[model samples]
Target chain A: MSRRPEPVQVVKERRDAALDTLVGGLPYLAFLGIRFERRGDELTAVLPFRDENIGNPLLPALHGGVTAAFLETAAVVELAWSQLWPQMEGGAGAAAPGVRPPLPRTIDFTVDFLRSGLPRDAYARAVVVRQGRRYASVRVEGWQDNRARLFAQASGHFMMPDLSAGPGAAFADDEAMDPAPPASEPR
Target chain B: MSDDQYLRIAQQFIEALPHARVLGLRLLSVSPGHAEIELPWAAHLVGDPATGVLHGGAVSTLMDTCGGAAVMAHPAANAGAATLDLRIDYMRAATPGQAVRARAECLRVTRSVAFVRATASDDDVERPVALMQGAFTLHAPRLAGEAT
Candidate 1:
């Protein structure tokens, strides 16, 4: 006979489920090869280095755009995952099931590069500064070797959909994006 | 350096980068203090599969590449430039299946730094998908007597 599942184990299961929902659904995150982990309430995003990610082969440094993309994805994933954490809505205890938050739409983002990103597994952590009915603001820090010596810091504002509308409302594309520019134009 | 040489360097810079090639970025034009680039939409580039929208990260990559190109195009810095800071404001989600274009202008450049501003739009130039401002550290050109 199996013993009762511990509270810690239960929380981990819920978090993993939440991650599957978030990461599995987002193709770009998969394309970037981003992974998520939890230590207590903190969430970290991991981007493992690949040959294709190098921008300056001479410096052998990670591309600036790759790091920025990782940071932004980290912030968004953290925000969405928070809704599934039991402690977020309720105080401590096992997480309640089926409270996944709606995915956010980025309104603005800023990344400040403090150092050149070396080729390695990069990690990022994010904190939600404010979460309101219609918007949320978050701050993210990215580092490789030492957390104190950060490679970059980023902050962003995201538009949160109306909760009363429906779960699918947040993903709706009300505005049309760019029309495909002519690819034949000479560079 | 002549404008033609600057253009050549800018083009080579984009082509040399593997990540830019992966994103399918094309260097459209580069003049003194200004550069324009284009990114074609791909299915793997979608941020939200539910909506088939291009990820904000993809747009950020386009902006960063354009801004760096603008800084390099500036006549003052013959060497190269690195990103110091970049801020992007997402005005709207890029509609799926549409190519996005980014135009960047190096607003100012000093002894050690360059400032740039850029806008990314789909088909309509007026309706932008994202706006960006960035600062880049410039590497000064080598002097006549300076050793390599």
Candidate 2:
């Protein structure tokens, strides 16, 4: 007889799949070679270094705009993951793994350059300062080599998607019809 | 510097930045305390594939670079400068397939800082896609015989 999959295992798989889909949906993120690593509900964004990402050839530093983009991506992805976590854990109102909620729209973002972003693989983590039904505020810190020595930090205000309209209604125009799975298999 | 000389220096300055090349940012005009740059639409820069809208990050990059160029062009801030803090507000999605232009002005320059404001617009100049304000650290030129 075949063994049935445990309920906890099924939930975990669904959550993982949804997270992948969410990140895969953003084409610009793919272009920048940004990936996410999830540990339980926490997520860390990684930006693999490429020559094209260099701004100052003399310093060989990562582009300041690219660094800001990385931080913003981290904040957006973290917010989405956090929103999906409760639904997955409850395992009741969960949408299918392929069907994701609309990505939040950024209202304003502010980035502070603490140091030059070294030309190397960089990492970032975002903290949600406030999350409400209509608005959310997130802060992100990016570092290379050392987590304590942040090269840059950013704060963003986002206008949350209005989910009350219906499933996928808010993002009907923006959602990618065919979100290709990431090229690299998840480790 | 003559207008032609200033233009050449600005173009060279922009070309030196690798990220500007990747984004296809072209210098349109530059004068003391003012600069304008343009980014032509490309497939790789699309943020929303379904809507064909350019990504906000692309716009941010353009505005940031334009702001820096403005700071660099300022008579009082001809030396190197780095962004200290930048804030951007998105007003609406950019019209797809249209080249976006960013114009920035250096509003003020203090001893060690320069203030800049910028706006990104498409063909419709009346409504801008985004607005930005930033402060940049003004680096003093190296003096003769200074340690490298």
Candidate 3:
């Protein structure tokens, strides 16, 4: 009889082939339910609006806390799309799939709100003014409908990590471990 | 809670919103998305121990509110919307023992969205210490007569 090969222990796994840069995040951001979608230069996403988020009554709108969250999400996602296109289009990025580096650390960001958000679903769209070698500039716009009035707008500057250093990421312990088995897994 | 009370709503916002702290953020004035707000340099807001500069989070909070109010003051949709997201980048630490104020203006407002830009500084508006921009949505009515 042929000798059986030793069992191979699956030590690592991934969702989209190679999304290394995506999973590494601070505990606070994960706690806040931030999501990133790489959809090319024209990026869009929805922040789940909840009534309980109102914090400051003096300004009285959707608390500024929530507003900042949206801006941060858009910035990272926009860059991802720009960086990921080649991979998706069957170039170099596609071969690696999920091994992209973590987003560059932010250096400085500026946000301006033209109007207050009422208690309603909000949508956001981002347009990049310039995506350069060391830094990238983006303009994100949030709205409910397309009534020409915006809920918020954002512009940000981020410092790209050296490719050799690979975004200098540190993963949380809990996040580093394997996710629990799904309920549908065979017993 | 008097309906006619002329006091600024900063206290009430803190009283009800447990997770959201004031962080020494104060309103200087509100004029059609063109407004001024302040951040007091206190013990709790300091991030560094040696020089005692204000924390980045504190400046971020001030920017968030100042920008939001600037948008709310827009003439198009007075009811207000919700904040889908906000992002801030700290240029550097601020000088200790000095209060900082921000000047904000609404750049544009759509039926569904509002845009704003702001600058923060201690004694100089020309050389801003920090820059901020945000977007807001409009509000619709809930059960009973209410404006959220």
Candidate 4:
């Protein structure tokens, strides 16, 4: 993958503004208190725990569904901010300072859970392993210990549309998306 | 003779399932030994071009639901079992706008857990869009009804 032309340095004002716009409409992560922090080459998202986020009542650990959602959200958001991919609804200008015009869709994902994330804020960082105009793959690491102890992780394959006809800056006009519904099993 | 008492709960169970509400999966039918779920088209939920085909994640969830229900119908004491591992292989894409259906068989269900295999298809069950196999733990006691 010829490194897609590196983007210009995202200035503070521009960066924060873009992030705020991108993060606002995501109902799922918002409910979980997921927030983003960007340094060079790396993107981070945090999940601040809530009482209702627990399922097993006994262990008081973050529910598995919540953990998986955190991992998926972080991976997709990382793709958005990293410029390797764009948010499904967001484009180059409003979400990331220098991201390319069109966004990539998550194609495939695999997640592994190492430890239960107890009730508290959980931190995650994602890195782009390979990137191309057509497809981009990323790996996301989520941790509760603050140092990457392998609490949860996921990797996804994504595809994007051609900018000439795809959803453009006008995407900003739509409201933020609600958190996607839970997994619907057969039965 | 009760032909299929578990049939009603089978369908209702999917509706009451918290995750199903969260994912937007709709229940189509739940009969004596069969069930089906539908995933309406949503760009974010799709993986391949089957624009209307159910998202792979949605398909996985449906498969689990079917497996869980199979265990629940078996007269097992425990009706709870967490998915330890789930694996799916995507074959073909469902038609855009058409709803995909999954038919699963309770291949083998034991006292501690059950194993199931399912196939997803657009128009033909023989020609499946995807195939899934999974194991579900029967958390309920050893008795739900007759052992399967």
**1 against 3, candidate with superior TM-score:** 1
The DockQ scores of all candidates, in the order shown, are: 0.46, 0.38, 0.14, 0.07
Sort the predicted structures by DockQ, highest score first.
1, 2, 3, 4
Global CA lDDT of candidate 3, please? 0.56
Number of the top-ranking candidate, with lDDT as the measure: 2
TM-score of chain A of 2: 0.83
Over the stretch A53-163, how does candidate 1's per-residue lDDT look in tens digits? 777677777778888999999998887766545443364432334444557778899999887778789999999999986679999999998888888999999876554
Q: What is the per-residue lDDT of model 4 for residues A1-187, given as tens digits with 9 covering 90 to 100? A: 6766435554445566666555554444554567888664356788877775553344445555456556666766776666532432233444334333343455555555455566678888878788776677888888875573667676766553444444443223212211112337331
Two-chain DockQ for model 4: 0.07
What level of docking quality does candidate 2 show?
acceptable
Q: Number of clashing residue pairs in every model?
A: 4, 0, 66, 23
Give me the runs in candidate 1 sitting further than 4 Å from their true place: A1-8, A86-101, A171-187, B1-9, B140-148
* Weakest ten-residue segment in model 4 chain A by summed lDDT: A172-181
Question: Candidate 3, which CAPRI tier?
Answer: incorrect
Local distance difference test values of all predictions, in order: 0.80, 0.82, 0.56, 0.56
| Chain A superposition TM-score per model | 0.78, 0.83, 0.64, 0.70
User: Tens digits of per-residue lDDT for model 2 on A1-187?
Assistant: 9977668776667767878877876778887889999888889999999988877677666777888888988988898888777877774544565766667777799999888777789999999999998789999999888888888999999877666566546644342322222447452
Give the CA lDDT, 0 to 100, for residue A106 in model 4.
52
